[model samples]
Target: MKIISFGVNNFRGITGGLENNTIEFNNSNTIFLLGQNNVGKSSFLKAYEFFYKNTSAAVEDIYRMNPENVIEFELVLQLDEFDFQKDSIANKKEGLKKWLNPDNLLKIKRVLKPKIGAKISFEKTENYTWDYEQNGWVAKNYGGIGLDTVFQAALPTPIFIKAMPTEAEGEAIINEILKQKANANLEDKDRLELKEAQAKIQELQDKLYNPESIQSYKEEVNKYFQSLFPNTKIELSEKDKTKWTENSIGKSFAIHFEQNNNGEKDETIPTSHERIGHGAVRSAIFSLLLMKDVAEEFERVDNRKDYIVLFEEPELFLHPKLMKQLRTLIYKVSETDTPYQVLCASHSPQMIDITKEKSSLVRMTKHNEGTRLFQINDEFLKDSKEIKTKEELKQEMNEILRFNPFICESFYADEVVLIEGPTEEIILRGYFNEVQIDKDIFIVNCGTVNNIPFFQKIFSRFNIKYHVICDSDAAEVKELDNYGLIPFETGIQKSIYQQLKSDYEKVDYSVGLFHVNVPTFEPSHQQESIKDNLKYSNNYLASDGKPYNENLYWKDVLKPNLNSEEINTVPIVKFLKNIVDHN
Candidate 1:
């Protein structure tokens, strides 16, 4: 079953009526919840669980809150066609009576109402009242199936594999399986009993020694060891392997172990589980459970339709490389016969890189009212030109800028000035005022020279007309050249004015630049005062007190030449005047 929509009410941080908050999964089978910490990503998952299983467990607990509290949650799910058809019952509403046909219509109608297939609830207590009325129909009918059974049977069991079993518990489970098989064939009078017993034994043996199973088990063991020793791999001896099976299963099983150290003697004897890291253990359990669930679904062959799998932080406790591998695995799983629809939440940029077009990303933010999930629009996708010309430049920029930083600033303007540092920004503003020009022209302090290429690419992507001003430092000149910005590596002030002169001659929008020369400013008394004022007043300015040069005062030179109230208005007015003169 795929969850189509959900609603939450008085649920911890989410209070009041929040209904019909729908999550539309990709028809192509992928979804993504892309948000930072604590914007209800986990709570959203809990809400889905709560809607299907309306037990009295604190719905608020799904969020970071007290378990005793109660919260109302509702979810809409789209079940497999077969399951829906099988569970559907005739509508029994009083108004539906007139529509019902007398000729066996009751029977047909009885099967027509939406089928309630499986109900699973997580209650706070055994006697807690389950709000069946609020639950999806599937939950209402399947409520008879205990929480454990429903979770095990209906949803994929591997989803909960993170819940670890104690050594004793693992033994008990293995033993129980053996006992069940033993008892089932106990009364067999023929050789069938022998065959069945042999089969059971083989199955258990395969689980122990099968390549995949062994690898998974080994990963789990290593995980436990890593938690105690960070940034280190545990060494396991052949004897240690023996001890693990001896302790976990029994000494009767043939186990192998290998020991290696960081070019040092192997002093520690670690079990397969012990040698493995804790992260591997957690992920292995989850992977194993998910695989098991997939196996079960394959065996049942009941609902062959697409399935939507919502994973909350699948990258949890995984290295970046491993996380990338996990993404590939998820994509592979979706390609199987029973194609899967996957929705995942992640904080890692690696995870973000894995997202494809089919994935729907929602960024969540906290508001005064409550948390809100905002769909990432196409605008967030860097434009085609930006993608083609400077993909690496854009990615690196995004890494440094952080996605949130740009969102906080104003980028909606048509004409923008990109400056290297806060000092330049302040000096330019003051110069603009001195020349009596409107300050409406958007001026962005890009934070650093290294980021200039990135912003330029972004502006080019959006087709925004923008000019960049930066120091003529040797490194800065080289960096700008790498970004296709031809730098005139002379004094900053002369270089900027020279570029402007050349640009005016070219009649091209791209032909504008700004640079500053520091040496000339030392003799000017006013320059020192300007530098001190910029250093003391503007918090965004760099700490180093750099004197401003003529390039910093370009706005003062240009204001009188332009005939508009707004700085951006000057260009538009000039264009209009040229157009009329040409006509």
Candidate 2:
């Protein structure tokens, strides 16, 4: 069984009911929850935890601490034939099978209306299940089982990895990994060693908890206690327990790192787990969560349990290279035979992988009505037959995004500035630096003027406000080396900015288009002599022997002219300032 969608109301900053605040899961195994802070990304994950645990809530859990408010959680679960066949409870299995919708989905809701002036608890909470015939949640006659019972007994549990995990939590995760390793199948030599170790532990337990030793320890405790109260008698009872459970034994285990200099005995040293850096500790915890061996064990079982991993700020303490590695590992684990879904509330663009068909990006925003969600649709060019096929457009997007992580940051921005090349990106960054305009604006270098329209299609599909800034030119189109032209969009190239505005005029949405009246950007508002120098400067290449350093134009040609008061009034600069002011 897997979660199809979750809804929350009056829980933390989420004040809207399920009707207004439902988050539907995507088809991909990994889903990225993108948002700025305080938009309820963490709160949404906690609501999933609450649905599974059904723990007590605090007064503050109510939205805005209103005493009259009630917290509600709703979940729609998707189940298959395998789920029904593996059920151990015959009664519940039959009832659930009968209650299942035609599409094999079940919607269950938990409502907690806190009692006035009493402890907040789930004892009096209302539970309901969606009825297909009625088309609403039905509280009574649920095939002899309540929604809470089915939800708890049938649904899969989630594993939540917090942003800042405590040391004890880290140890607990490591112990879980070790415990799985111990229980997994082993070779003859390892089996022999494990048995021998267990036998020795048993011997120690027998000596420590025997009747004679218990009597002696009891006398020692009572001797000290009796001195404080002369007339009182202390009694000690022995249950004859001598064996330690697997959890108890695991608690005694500790993780250590070893350092040595190529087989030199003098340099050998052991570093305790506590002494390790936080980055190393977090890496170790998440690395163990891959559970390759445990996944194999799961494959062998007929009734495998499913899990959804909730990770908050997975790039908390890791460097860029490590963040890439961690992101790769997450996708690797999800693709395995083990049933797992990974969702992360992340701020790093490095953690995003929208190239995958199943991967999805959802943005959360706060408003007068509370937190609302927006998702990027997979089919952006489905109806765009005039330009290119959907598959071709998608392939182009994936190829460019694979090599450019900076462009991926546009998914998190409140407003975007789409430029033609790195020259524009550098100039905009410099402009924003000179005049500090506070806004969550992301400038994406589309690599070429023609491709700006494709990216505009993306922002339009996701309802993200964006501005397009490209040159106004009429030149003979040339075939590029790195990229191919969109079919039917070639032949003779006119002003691409004007064509973009014409296309957006037909749509219900509006796009901000900023372009200079001059033929190209290099000569915009420049004198004839400076324009000649700008053209000549493009001939010189940097030390790396690639295309001329894009920054060279910014520092040598653009910077000096930008200082002039007249240059600040250029169309591109003024348009950028407007974006920062309005957004």
Candidate maximizing lDDT: 2
Tens digit of per-residue lDDT, candidate 1, span 1-583: 4434445644545443453234554243455565546666666655554444543443334333533333544433333433323222212233323322332121100010111225323433321112333322322332222233322233321121123433333333333323222232233342353354543544443443445543544454445333323334432222223222312432122222244466443547655655555455544333422332222333223332333455667767777667766666555444434345566666654655322444445554454555655443223444412453334535644554562244213333445676766545555655455544432355667676555555554444333455665555542333344324445554443344444444435432343343333322222212433333222223213344453433333334333434433433222223223322321
CA-lDDT, candidates in order:
0.41, 0.61
As a TM-score, model 2 comes out at: 0.73
Candidate 1's TM-score: 0.42
lDDT of 2 by residue, 182-208 (tens): 333333454454466765555443442
Any runs in candidate 1 off by more than 4 Å, and if so which?
Answer: 26-30, 59-70, 81-269, 272-276, 289-300, 303-312, 315-319, 335-341, 377-583
